[model samples]
Each structure stands twice: as structure tokens, then as C-alpha cells.
Target: MSQFSTPLATTPGIMLVRVGQAGCALRWDAQAACWRWPDPQGGQLYAWPAQDSMPSGVRLLESAGLIACCRSGRVLLGLGKRLGSVELPAAGQSGRPLQAQVLATIDAAEARTVISDGRTDRQGNFVFGTANTGADQRPIGSFYQYSTRHGLRRLALPVVVAARSIAFSVDGARMYFADATRGDIMQCAYDAERAKVSDVRTFASVPAPAPERGAAVVDGAGMLWSVQGGALARYDADGHPRQRIELVREPVASMAFGGPDLRQLLLLGARGGLYGLPAGVAEELAPGVADTPFDDGPAAVVDSQRPHHGD
Candidate 1:
């Protein structure tokens, strides 16, 4: 079931794409005409071909992009099959992608840690973190930045047991990250020009009962959106609570700002279901997603009805 606060009532325009187990890192692929996410339980990367079509599950290889801290698997920077130039069709057309090929593969992390949370910086370089997934959850994880030129360079920062809320400011001057058990969302000054981070401090503290949160996304207004406890909480750049809407009975598994003009707040509930609400902030268009001419997926069904998981 879903519950909405005053904020949800205020933003009545809703759009929904019925998908499930979108654990984190919801990305839009313009060339392939699909939305991509990693299934934490299934240990595979799944791609949804537009709003109304069926989802295509792509099996993971031995090594690739990583997430779902508990399990080990490969992820992706770009979605493909490596069979050479396979052009995908628009929605309702046949050639939806079922296999994901590796466009770029980076170096691996330490044996004890797993790649947990990550996102691209303002410059589009992959900035992610490793986490200690051992039973004791030791703080042996470190952050790393990867690019074609620099390859993979680890950052000089304190270790963490788990990583969440990995996001950046609009200008990429500030970075926000949190360890699942730490309760405090930390802020660090990011130097995109020099690829450095410093001035670490607490940005916001998660209260009891909602300490664990999902990955966060920054809106066009420079505010933050994260799934806290059983609802979606909004915070200002200075870390003040702006508003909160209880969309589900449990914490959300993943969320991101997608859809046309990047104004839709797409979130997957902890139990299961996908929901979208009008965010009203016209965000910066994602790489290749907006400039490239592709079929506009589908007009989502606008309503407050609870979304059900599909096959």
C-alpha cells in the first residue's frame, strides 16, 4: 500500500512505470530506449523497454559494475551485448535488448569489500564506494573515482561498512554520502577540477527508526530526495528538512529523477512497486538522453493507485 503526505497531495501529477527490485542506480539509456537497474536478489542487470513493454533481464558476467552490497555481481557503465553495433528499436517494436554488453570495464576492488553505492560526478566520471560486507561489517571500504584517462584511483578517506546517499551538488562542488549504520549523512567539499575531496563533516543525521536510507538524488532546486524510514524525505542544501511524504509502509529500495525534462520523481518501494510524482524542478538533462532523438516512451497512467509488481 501507499500513503502520501501533504507534499504528495500538492503535486498531483503522477506517472508510473511498473517495475520491481530496482535496488539502486536507475539510469536512462537513450540509444537503447530503456531504463536500466540492477536486481539485488536476482544477481542480474534488468532493462525495461519503455513504460508499457515487458522488462528484459540481462545476465551478469563474472566481473563488472557492482551494487547490492550483500551479494557480489557485475554492473554496467553502458548497456550492450558486445555483438557489435546492435541498434535497438522504439517501444512496441521487436528488438528490445535482452543481453547487456560491457562498453567499459574498470578495475576491481579489494576481496573483502563490495562496490555498494555510486553515481557520476558533474563531469560524468564514475564516483563510487566499496563497502565491507563481512558479517561483522568492518569499516574497510574506500571510495574510488574511475575515468578512461585516469583508470581507477582510490580516495584518501575514512572507511565505512556500507555506503548510501551517494550524490553530488548541482555544480558538483559538494558530495553527500552515508554509511547505512552511521546515522549521519556526511558532506565533503568536492574539487571536480582536481578530483579531490576534503572538509568532511556531518550534513544531516537520520533519526531513530529510519537510520537506513536509500541512495539520494539532487533536484534542480539543489535540494535532496532520499527514502527515509517509511516515506520520502526532502532536505535543503543546508540539510534542513523541507518536507516528507509517506509513500510506503517501508523504506524505498531505490530512487532517481527521470522522465521527460527530468521532473518526475521515480521511486521503488521496499516491498515492491514503482511510483512517480511531479517534482516540478526542471533538472539538467542526462547525458545523451535528451539531445538524442528517441521515441518518447509512453504516457504513464496518472493516478494515486497502489502499483503492483508485475511478471
Candidate 2:
């Protein structure tokens, strides 16, 4: 395996896109042919085509924290304390107001909480993490999985102070999760069919002086791409550190591989706007992993189920 040495040259990323508000939960909507992200601060979901400066907005979700494109082509939104979906207006129908359909409301047991980061598994089940919004910054957040057959089932993991990134291996055999409070990223064996996770282990640990880690993604070659402070770090499948790509003085909140061939690395900055790096750098640093298509399965719940509150 190749190793990245210290003082690696900083390859400045270019600013390709900009959002009306700071964005998070950056994802590509293949069916819609645009990139989607939620600006919770702005209370709107925004979509922009790959080569366009004009971004369309949907004002349906209040505090739309995170977003995922469902198999049915609707957008799954994490609306603060609720899980909801909205059918995005087709091209040229941008003038109509999008309506949100609440699927589940997560109760926080008298404590303020909001759904944070989320993603779909290989089997198309939606998995999301929550964070305590109380002033105490308490470690009372939990993770849950939703499916048509199972409604919503909370996972067995320790309560986290702040849940950040969520990603899965190419084959869906492994799942990665990050807790920004502790600055630790953990990997566990994921059984997609049963919607179960096991053997939770540490994948990477970010130390002080490094900004808290955020969302992470697995490249085509199974390498993990995660944000560490102001730079993007590349890691092997097993969590060994490799190369680091320095950004243009902005902290990356999340990232995804997009573009027609899925080679472009789009980075979402915490301050606002988007950055792009040559797909070639990702390919050269982590070769052999094939692109894993986004899960576009329909988001469904048989019935509304009560979400378990963190103790």
C-alpha cells in the first residue's frame, strides 16, 4: 500500500458552486440531475445543476437539516425534530410551493433535539442520527433506521453528544459513523438485509487543534473521505490515514462525488459555498474502488412509530 508523507503539497480546490445559505447534507440527485443540500439556517432545501449558477429552492421544510434523494425521486428531509419527505417540483415547475409530508416525529423526552446527519443503506433503508439541541450540549442523541416493513427502529449504540457523518462501504458490509463531540469515527459490520450493525470499532480519531470532524464518504475504491479541520483526508478501507487535500482556507462540512462520471469531488464549506477538486486526485490516491450508486428507493413507513428517546 502507498503511504502519504508529511508536508504534502496543498492542492487548492476551486469554488464551483454557492448556496444562498450555508449548506449541509450535500448529496447528488441523479434523477433530478442536480446536487441537493439543505440550508437549515435558511430553512430551505436548495438544488443546483452541475454547471449552472442558478439554484432552485424549496421552502417546504422548516429547519431542513439534512436531505436524501429517495428511490421514488422524492427528497427525504430531516426537519429538526421530524422526519419528512417532499416531492420536488419537476423542471420548470419551480414556482409552486413544495409541501412536506411528515413521516415521524422524534420526541426528545423534554430535552430539545434535532435530527442531524443521515443516509440510506444498500438495502434502501433510511438511517439517521440525532443531536441534542439543548444549551447543555448533552450527550443524549441516538440513531434510528426506517424502512417500509419496520417503521422506525432505534439502533444499539451509546448515546452521542453530537452525531455527524454517516457512510457505508461499497458492498454495504461496513458502516461508518462519527461523533463530533468526541472527534472519533467508528466502523461497524452492517447487515443490510436484517438492518443490523455489529462489532463497532474505531476507524479514526481526530485530536485537538484539528477542527471537529464532519460528514464522510467512501470512494469507489472503498477508501474513506472525511473532513478534518480545514482539509479533506483520505483513509484506507480499514481506517488507516493516507493523503490529505488542503482546501482554500474554508472548513468543509461535508463532501460527495458527483459529475457525469462520478469523478468530481464536491466539498461543502461550513462558512458557505461549495468547492471542487479534480477527480483525478481522488482516483490517483485511492484507485480500484468502483462508484457506488446512490440509493433511490422509495422512502416508506408502514405506520408512524414512536421514536425511542435517549436516556
Candidate 3:
């Protein structure tokens, strides 16, 4: 009883690659021509050459967390409640392990909280969220932003059980955040210059029976590509549900857009594997949309509503 027209494993457009034990925080490091991600539960960071299937791994500071490539060629890592940076070893330094330098740390107080998801904004600032890691997984996690100019600051969103899937609109005027516990994706007006987010409202609500949401990315046409369980869903700028791409049986931990034109959709499977869909699939899903735009515009506020995903 799936909405997809064809079985995911049988689709010619999709390709799969095994990468790790549980791949998350997938990102494209354009400057280095490589893809980066972390095995949050495995305490490992990984980098794969853009054109090769082999991946290099490094021990991380935290037992598990997320990672984002920074503008300085180093990677920003969100481990537990601390944010740090690490430089990937040079080509010939494969024998040496990379190390993380802690830049900022957050005291979770008595609760056992850890960083869950992270991404870099258009302005080169790193934004990430934290979640309670206790047995009950309480709704005490919060969102934060970090930059060299302003340091680290928390956002004004209500505490949630867990936060995942952080993304920005094509023009960077809107920011999308997903609360995995509530199965809701929220959008807010983002001001990159001032590094502020406001007018938080629900954008889409995933239907019941779906797994908790995972990582997400925005396409050139302003559509949000979000992963949940073993499928990827597309939502238009207004939060209208569009197409859905069925992936492997395992949950998709994260994803990134890469390739020379940035149309290749790279998926990180929770089982520590990498998968991809040809650029043509992305072009078909987001036709006429251009890459991230620099022009700034006023943020739009829309009433929260659940997008209709037909049965």
C-alpha cells in the first residue's frame, strides 16, 4: 500500500552504495570535491571522493553526532552538546586520523542531551539542534546558531523531543525545521544578514504510520526534499506535498545535493550505506528551479496546515 508507482529497488533511476554502519549528516564539500558525513552512533566521520565509492573514516570527539563542511575547509561537528571543527587529513595522510577542536560547548544541565542535526546557512554560519538522549527521550531539546561574528545563540522555538531535517529555501529567505516526534515540518522567515529566524509556523505534517523524519535539503525550485523512514518526499514552497521517492527498506539518515551541477541527490541510509539518483530525476522533480539565489526578499508568513497526502 505505497504511493510510489514502482518498487524502489527496481527503479533504474536509483543507485546504491554501502558506506558505513549508520550514515548521517551527509554533505557535499564542493571545495574539496568530496562528500562528508558522520556515523552518529558509530562515533565516526567519513569522507568519500566525489567520483569514487571508497570512503575514509576518522574517529570523532563525540560518540555520535552531525557534521557540516565550513567555508575554511574544516568541518564543523556537532557532538553531544559541543560544537567543534576538524580538518580532513591531506590526500597522503590517510594513515593519520583527523582530530576535532572544540569551539563552543553547551551545558545540558542535568538532562543528558546531545546534538542531533546540523547544517550551514547561506551566510556560512553553522546551525544545529539538540535533543534529550535520556531513556525517555523527553522534549527538552532546543535549536542554536553559531558564527565567528556572533558566537553561539539559541533560537526561540519551543522545546521538542528531537529536531531533524534543517534546510533553507533556494533564496535563503526561509528556513525549515522538522520535529521528528510530531511528524511536522516548520518554516520560518530567516534573515541571513542579522542571523535571525521568526514567524515559525507549521509547513507540512507527515501522515501517520511514517517513521520519524530525518535530514532534508531544499532544491533550486524552492522545493523541500525530506526523508522519513525509507522514503523521500517533496514539498513545494507553500508546503504542498508533491512527489515521493521510495528508497531502501532502511531509514534514510540524511541526504545532500552534489555533482558539478548540484543535481545529484546523495542519500545516507541509516544502515551505513550511500545511495544516489541520477540528476535527471531531480530535474524532473524540480523543473525550472535555479540554484540558491542571492537576492533577498521579505519573509512570508503562512498559516499552519497539514498538506494533503492522498491515500
Candidate 4:
């Protein structure tokens, strides 16, 4: 395999994408055609489009911009020219306080590590887990599906709670996610037609349960990869980790697979850093290929929305 190495370069525009204190999630939103973030402000969402000039609230925004989820629990588009905050009529509540917003809420309370992927299903459905962050925080995170047909419907997945990571299969039929507490990746047999989830089985699990586990993505091929401890681990279709590549930096935060050719895997390391590794078809590291520089954004997101007290 051809291994490529180079000093990571810095991207100045990246810093402009900072929306929250601590940036938690980043997804390419196809609807508004921009990048989105669950801002530190509990009830608010933010977004920016690719390569737009800096906006007010954002310190260093991503070239792709930032989108925040609003106090009403609706996501606000912040990137490019798609600058407007709107509400997702379907977002519900975990009945938790706004002292710590959604990201922390997901970290403490929710079992699964989930954020909006920016794209709904063929039927326009999405699922998010609630963060439960206390000694009594249960892994039993809730799942919701949004569509015009039945509006927002919550599915009762037998709570196996852990810091969970979620992703849809290439076909969007099978749902794959990770249970960080148990260090196992799981596949939930999902019925998109009926909007039901069942047949939960362990697809893969980490050898050691790493804290602050980040996002996951499936390549053009049916492969899985995750970032932890400033390194990237590749998993086979069976959810078994085949190889782990350590990063020069510690505490890798997030990762994305993008390039003109889609051969480069872009890793978002904590402390405002980015690393590139040739993944999938470009599995061979290109010699002398330098790590891409990254700009820093927020420190940590704070929950501001009040919890649903239940009427």
C-alpha cells in the first residue's frame, strides 16, 4: 500500500464555521445544501453553506458553513446564502432541563451518539437520541421518524443504551449504529415502510470502550470507520475492526469522506485540526500527501432550552 505523508495545512475559512462553544456534529445537509451543527445553545440550530463569507455568531465557520438547531428544536440554516433559522415541526423533547443543551444532553442521557445527518430518508424521516448525563442517565435514548404521512412517530427500541453511533446502510434499509458503553456496533433491522426497528444484533464492538466517541460514516463501499483517541479505525462489513491508524494528534473528534474524487478521508481532530487519509479505493496512503489544516470552532455546546415537564 502506498503511504502518503505531509504536514497538515491549515484552512482559514474553517474557523468561520464555529457555531457552538464545543462543536459536536457536522453533516452535509442536502435539503438546504449546506453544512449544519447542533449549536451550544440548547434550543437553537445553526448552518453555513460551502465557502460563504463569515457571519456574526460564528467565529470560524466551515467553508461549508454551519447550521444550528433552534430553541424551538428546529434547525436554522447558517451557511452560504441559506441564512435563515426555521423550526422542524416534528422535534419533540426528552423532558430534560436546558441547563445543558442537546449535545451534552446526548452525551449524558442518550444511549446512542446521534446527530441530524441533514438528509431525511426516502420518505423524509430522521432519528435522534436524547443525551442523559447523570448517574441515573439511562441508555434508553428515544428514536423518532419524520414524514408527512404520520408526522413524528417514536419507535420503541428496547433500550440497550450506551454512547451510540448511528448510520444508514448504502441502501438506507439496514440501520447500523454503535453502543459505546458496550463497545459494540449494532445493526437494527429497520422497516422503512412501516417505520419500525427490531432485530437488534451486535454487528461490531470496540475492544475498549473509548470515551467521547465521535461520528461514524460508511464509504461508497459497505465499510465502516470511526475516530477515537486521535486515530482512525477501519471496520469490515461484519463490523470487525481490521486496522487502526493513529493520528499525530491526540483526541480525534470527527471525520468526513470527501474530495473531488471521494478518495480522501478528511478527519476532524480536536483542538481545531484536520487529517487526511486515503480510504476505501484509495486505501493506499499517497506518499508525501500532507495532512490538511483545520480551523477551530466552539468549545462546547450548552443546553438552553427548557425540558418538557409533561402537561
Best by lDDT: 2
Rank ordering of all candidates by TM-score, starting from the highest? 2, 3, 1, 4
Arranged by lDDT, best first: 2, 3, 1, 4
C-alpha lDDT of all candidate models, in order? 0.54, 0.72, 0.68, 0.43
Q: Which residue runs does candidate 4 get wrong by more than 4 Å?
A: 1-21, 29-119, 160-163, 208-212, 259-264, 278-311
Better of 2 and 4 by TM-score: 2
Per residue, candidate 4 scores C-alpha lDDT tens digits across 1-311 of: 11111233322112223333444455444344444444433333334444454312232222222333332344433222112333332223333222221221222233333332222333334443433344664565444443323333555554534334555666767776654454556677767557788788877655553443446666666676665444556666777665565545435556554434445555544444344443342455322111111111233333312222111
- Specify the poorest-scoring 10-residue window by lDDT in model 4: 287-296
Better model by lDDT: candidate 1 vs candidate 3: 3
* Residue 134, candidate 4: C-alpha displacement in angstroms: 1.7
As for TM-score, the candidate ahead, 1 or 2, is 2
Worst 10 residues of 1 by lDDT: 78-87
lDDT of 2 by residue, 123-240 (tens): 7777888887788988888878776556777877767877776888988788888876575689888876566778998887655444666788887788898776657788886777
CA RMSD, predictions in order? 11.6, 3.8, 8.1, 11.6
TM-score of each model, in listed order: 0.69, 0.87, 0.83, 0.57
Q: What is the lDDT of residue 75 in candidate 4?
A: 47
Clashing pairs in 2: 71-296, 71-297, 220-289, 220-290, 221-289
**How many collisions per candidate?**
4, 5, 0, 66
Number of clashes found in candidate 3: 0
**Residue 104 of candidate 3: its Cα lDDT?**
71
